[model samples]
Target chain A: MAHDIDTLSGTEVSRTSMPEEKRSDHALIEATKSGDEAAFGEIMDRYRSPITNYLYRFLNDYEEAVDLAQETFVRVYFAIDRYHTQFAFSTYIYRIATNLAISEIRRRKRRRLMSLTGLFQSEEDTQVEFQPPDTRKLQDTELVEDERSQIIARAIAALPEKYRIPVILRDIEGRSYDEIAEIMQLGLGTTKSRINRGRGLLKEKLQHYL
Target chain B: MSDEDLQNNEPVSRLLGELKHVEAPSDFDFGVRARIAAGRPAEKGGFRIPVWLAYGAPLALVLAVGGYFALNSFYSVGDANVPVVALNEKANVAAPIPAPSREVVSAPPVTKPDDQLVVKKPDVVSDSNVVAVKKPIAKDKNAGGGSIDLASRVGRRFHATPQIPAKTVLDLIGAKGSFEADGWRVQSTTPNSLAERSQIQTGDVIESVNGQTVTDKSTLRSNTPLKTVRVRRDGKSVDIVIKN
Candidate 1:
């Protein structure tokens, strides 16, 4: 019930009245460590969507990002014993999510290399052929804006991971520099710098369309 | 375009707005709660085994027994079994008959030389076919002549085997794995170029490229060599090509 109020939009909402909710992250963490499933669940319910969105933006693939987000929660759950109240709960969760994302990216890269070989071989042999679907008729009904969205998604994908992550967090997720730094475990200056650089890279890559 | 104009750009604003509406899956809350429930540890006052002793004592016993059996099995697997039996047999033979002292046995025997040399090396010494001399090494001048240092011999034997060099590739373009919070990551691979062609489907773990193990995406991008790539796909080995 307390989370219902906290979930409302705008910065002016008061947090002092909800005593149970007002309990510091440390209290919830201590309760969770003592086998209090409800407290743990409360934490999960509160953070899950934001964390999922964070990962989704970080990783363009919806399904994979969702899976990693779930794994991040699972890890957080299991590592509850190791949770120190010294750091913000957000930082801890973000660190776990970021690690999983990084691992997934590495795995994807390896797969891409293997797939590239298959592509080349298939191209040269021509025997292993895949027929292209007829797109002309479909294109007639599709909106021009929808096509533009597809192009933009591709352009975003084309940007290197370095530039991409900050852009997603800053622009797409609309997180402040302080939040981004905490999530990324970087200094405030570095976080801002990355956002700037990321935007520059995106602009340059998308300049052709612009 | 000016900074002011860019800030008010409709497309950018629209994109950001659209991104905000990207809701998590319907089961997201359920999944998270389930994980949290599963991960919650038992209460300290709750009826449960002590965490350390529960794991520690059994682990210690296992290591001790394991070490004993491992050493025992390693040494006892071969001719050691036969010698142990032969030693037991010799003890049985010596038990029944009192053997004469070495001084008396060494005295010039009235019997034939063959009968005098009855104290032969035990028949159980079948390991190397090298005869075991019962006398002290100082008395046996032939001991040093035929004996070889086992360590030096083994070392020399392996020295002849050629060492295989690890190969590496450079200048590959791909996402890097990092622990850093703000690191970039690949969101998805659209059906395209090197990624699609290489049969690198989603969720494949890239262990290395051209024999070079990559730590991060930058390392992967910079160190990817123009040659064959080695990757693990579905827990199996796969090779990919990198066109020069």
Candidate 2:
């Protein structure tokens, strides 16, 4: 319900005036550690949208983003006792999400290589099952917007991983440069340079949009 | 903020910021709670050996080790089957004589008279069948009256004979085999040579050159013009004069 407001405005809205919303992330984690499950739910509510949006932009695949986002929360839930408050909770969660996304990317590359080798395999060796295809209709304007969004997503995905991550955190997710540096375990200067480089790359790829 | 901060607020950054933000699906909370309830799925695909390899590798290693020991034991038994005769090399004995399927017994060293050579057979320790050769040529003058012992080569399989010492004089004279304690034991004579033409046969021992005793080191005799050669064949002395 809270996420709908943020989605409609295309910006982060203020938290609702609920008792859990007013509690700091550390306070909520403390509560969860003290056997308060609702506190953990509130923490998820706070991070779920941002983390999902971050992962979706990074992967350019909605299903994978949602899966990774859920996994990130699951990790946080299980490892709550180990979560240190030295770094901001946002930095810690983003770091975990980044690592998961990188692993998924590498896995996709391996899968691609295996599929290439499988090209020589006989047709009978491959099991093919029929499934019904999508039959949803799209309006003309919606089709154009969808195509543009796909092109932008492709350009962002095409950037080298070093640049892509920092650029997305700064520009799309509105994470501060210092927070990006802490999440990446890189120097602030290095993080900003990568963000600039990523933007330069995206500019080249999306020249028509610019 | 650094100069990089100014670049961050540029048009491309602005364009990126204007891009539509995505929120988690409505059922995202349900999914997380479900995953928590399920605990974690067993992790997949980290350093997993294939099923075939896990079994096949150890089997191949065991087979390799077993094959090595098998071959080693087989060769050891084969070497044991053949008796190795170690000679008393100090006595200037000839190389081991090949004697198939026969055990050679070594008699005690016989006392020699001042003018005769007493060739003693070396001590024989046989593990199977036995044969005895007492002593060789007690009356041979050329041996300088000292006894030498020899080991017999004993095996069930046909063994390669001891290599004959190369006698340059005998080689030039178209003969093979060594000059023994008694005389030059003629093992073979060259075909169509002077030795063959004179009807010199194998097993014939040349006892003298014109009745003069020649020792094993007799080299100058090869250059001497052929005249008469007395040979002992089958224990009888015979004189054959060469047609020079």
Candidate 3:
């Protein structure tokens, strides 16, 4: 198990501990390209949780987030040959995940537009459909935490997609502004502007929590 | 401070950062592996058709059917334009010379005296020779002199008046005659006509024109210019070349 600190943003680019393999993302991708299925599985193990979390915050639905995260890995696996190493693997994977999330959001909008239940409700109502069913009992503290989490999730989801993506990547995913710009295919100034606008919007909604 | 510094230090960013991170489900790796093993979704059912081909195939079929029928109707109209004979009481058989605005009467095929000269109608007719005939109408004796009424009366009389040795192929090709059974017995020729210029006299019986034997049912193609007239004169068949 080896660890590498990413200098640009102080995030961990390496796994916390894995006894069998500790290859870098580029090395693992090259191994996957050479028909190493285990290398691809390791790559999936490294990024899946973070990608799933990012999508969950973006969509405010756990099930859809998991589904899109899996789809992201599948897309990366099949299109690995076309993947250029000029961009970081994280940027490439995040971009794939972002596009998939946006597409899922649009699909949900179209479905809601056509459904009777969705016709009269505000855009906030779109979050309910793909929510993973939680049947387990919750203690008082956990319940309180869950309620606050839902409010924060809803506030983030309510932001317009342009602002939502950059805000989620910056604050929640801890991606640097340069990386966010690369993932969004936007200029640095525009990415910073959108992140500020998103924070302004979130500040109004989460004033109590702040 | 700059917007970037404010965005970085914002309390909203801290709150968002403090929120709980959602992890992928425990079976997530298994699910992805299973999906990869299954390959891309089976195209709904084994195969997929192109959207253009699906819609275009039916559209092309409709166009083909419509075009075939449209072309068929046009050919039918062209077939109707061909000259056909009208039946008469006497052996006076020839294509009906039409009156204006009248329905053309086409006859059943008539047998000729010389069976070799089939009396069936010609498949092509010149625009000048194309005529339409209608069933004869009773003349209105008390009709006033209005142009429409006058035309109706004239057409009625023209049909009612009995034909003498009826108009023959010779009549269509600039030779007006009371065509007898033997040949076209020349009644009269207009000045500078093919008959008159060919030296065909009133009494001379035309046996053939351009080597085709003349009969009551025999027809000369109106589109073709008359070349020579074979007439029986003084107990001899003489072929006379007609100048154009």
Candidate 4:
């Protein structure tokens, strides 16, 4: 029975990988553009987690990041006709995600300007939703792994946009310098420099806890 | 620099690695896939209601109304200033009546056809003979032969006005809007055209034309007058001539 279960899971994994790995992003994109909604859903399912994580770091808000990630994929779905295969599909999607994040940031800034209390309201709402129970009890109850993860997320959220983006893409998303350069629309040299700088900044910011 | 320093930084790298594995919400994939499905090309496609029309319809209506008033102000002379002359050939009478510098300001009072000779000089041009005359005729013939109607002349002037030129670059990859890239350059003007004549450089970044903001190279090319181009060159704004 154990062997059968293993075989079933392995077969499922292989079945999912078969279509995705065999078909290039370009092929999926072409299919999506031609009105194959399933093709786009497949693309989204493949990249959604990384895109969401990237946006979460950029926005520092889970709900907003999720919304933006959804928006990014939606935009990608419509704009597949314009997607060129010159760069990796990952680079293309990251570029779209980054642009959306920037626009969201700008929009938040505008909203903040319109109403001073608006900024605090969003934070209050997030806290209401994501706040833990009483500190001492929470600490006692929380798993070590979960606590460590939460601390890491908070540290990431503290970094500036320029540093945070490159660091998140390089370290978190596991993207290479060339891919990062294409996504950020910066030169390779600049991309490497930014990544190094981002890491250094993150180290400096989080040195106390570590 | 040193192995000690590198070792100290290892925790940061490890933490970053841990952060990489941060699990997104369970429904994230489902939500994004749904959105992607929604954004997919409609199975049946043709010219749809423009996105801008939905957003800008109110602003467009307001502008259309304002534009009508502004145009009317430029062309409309007060009705009182219109000249009125009455010729009663049937009455066997003609008056070198003072061409009332002002036509009757009020609508004509009720009057019989024979009594319509009452040319209420400055108030109304009650011509018993002609009905529905709404324009001023040039009394000075030498100004232009056969009394060129001023209203008609203005109408022709407005009618002959050229439309603003524009071009659109669709199906672009990498770039979002028109001027999203530094190296994304466009040469819009034809050689020796009005744009060229005005010394509008081919590679110049068009910022605006006639107070209208241009967001992309296509907008700059199409909306900018070939005769006048406002461009940003070497970090300075300048207007150059382009021959139409």
- The digit string of per-residue lDDT tens for model 1 on B112-197 reads 33322222212121111112212121112211111111211222334331111111011112222222322222233323223334
How many angstroms is residue B53 displaced in model 3 relative to the true structure, after the best TM-score fit? 17
Evaluate residue A171 in candidate 3 and report its C-alpha lDDT on the 0 to 100 scale.
95
For candidate 2, write residues A1-210 as lDDT tens digits.
778866865543334433443889999899999999999999999999999889877887767788899999888888889999998999999999999888777665444434545435554433220111112332223233365666676677666678889989998999998999999999988888888877877777787887
Worst 10 residues of 1 chain A by lDDT: A126-135
Q: Which candidate is the best by lDDT?
A: 3
Of candidates 4 and 1, the better by DockQ: 4
Ranking by DockQ: 3, 2, 4, 1
Which tens-of-lDDT digit does each residue in A1-210 have in candidate 4? Answer: 999999999999989877544577878888887888777767876788788878866666666677777777777766777888887888999998898887666555444434545434575453332222112222223222356566666666656566668878877888887888888888877776666666776687677767
Question: On a 0 to 1 TM-score scale, where does candidate 2 land against the true structure?
Answer: 0.48
**In what order do the candidates fall by lDDT, top score first?**
3, 2, 4, 1
Model 1's alpha-carbon lDDT is 0.47
Give the per-residue lDDT digits (tens) of candidate 2, residues B1-244: 4576556447788888877777788899999999889887323345755556755776788799999999655533422211222212221334233334332445454665664433343323223322222223224422211111122222222223222122433443345667898988888875544455566779988876555544564322111233566789889998876421
Better of 1 and 2 by TM-score: 2
Q: Residue B13 CA error for candidate 3 (Å)? A: 0.6
The list of candidate 4 runs beyond 4 A from truth reads: A1-21, A117-145, B1-10, B24-244
lDDT of model 4, residue B56:
68
Q: If you score just chain A, what TM-score does every candidate get?
A: 0.69, 0.77, 0.78, 0.73
